[model samples]
Target: MTKEITVTINGEEHTHEVESRTLLVHFIREIAELTGTHIGCDTSSCGACTILIDGKSAKSCTILAVQVNGKNVTTVEGLATTEGVHPIQEGFKENHGLHCGFCTSGMMMRCVELLENNPNPTEEEIRWGISGNLCRCTGYNNIVKAVQYAGAKLRGDELPSTEPVFVE
Candidate 1:
């Protein structure tokens, strides 16, 4: 059996009929065609399928599409606008936080929530906050720097002059 659900995705409202077992990640990717939210580990261990559900970071793979009915979901594609890229995205680029890029979207989405709640997080806190998201490359040093860069930007402070050391 299928159930109807209406979810606002990236500010656009979408109504669809989905199977009760349909994962929210699949709904966002397959039905909404917002492919930025990846499905790395369907069991939610990898955190690659993270998305903002009603202003909170959630592992989309662990949620059913019906579970998000009438909720607002934000994918990585929603983070930017006509003005420019989001600060977190800019941080990733400026700090060289991404490689291979499979986990970039989830990292950014998770960091968005982290920075929102704690605009000035310590390096250790940043690491702990994003402990769920796994990146095979970059060694997480640059990723941590990227989050720090974003926190500085969000706090209206002078941007860091030093660039993060890139790891192969």
Candidate 2:
């Protein structure tokens, strides 16, 4: 059966007729044309399709489009505004948190919720927080630092140096 559902994504309402079994990630990518939400694993083992549903991080692949009916969704594309890039995005860029870039969008989305809940998360806390999201690149050290950088930015503290450090 098909259902016409309306979901507000990135402050834009999208109404589409979708099958009952259509995954939210597919709806976002195919229907909404938001390709930033990658589909790494359809079984939900990988967090490449992670997105925010009503401001809470969720695996898009595990959710049905109908489940998010009338809800607000935020994909990676929503993270930035006309003023500037979201701190998480900047953090990933400045800290070199991503390598292949396939997992970058989902990783950053998860970080958005992480920082929202704990603006000053320790390195260990950040590690634990992003355990659900998997990144094959960057070894997660910089990902943790990226989250910390975003946390500092969100807390209005003095911004950290974005300078790259080369190890001899």
Compared with the true structure, all predictions reach lDDT values of: 0.94, 0.92
Q: Model 2 segments beyond 4 Å from truth?
A: 163-168
Tens digit per residue, CA lDDT, model 1, 28-110: 99999999999997888888999999999999999999999999999999999999999999999998899999999999999
Give the CA lDDT, 0 to 100, for residue 161 in model 1: 57
Instruction: Please write out the lDDT profile of model 2 over residues 1-168, one tens digit for every residue.
Output: 999999999999999999999999999999999999999978888899999999999999999999999999999999999999999999999899989999999999999998889889988899999988888888888888888888899899987776666689
Cα TM-score of candidate 1: 0.96
The residue pairs that clash in candidate 2, if any, are none
CA lDDT for candidate 1? 0.94
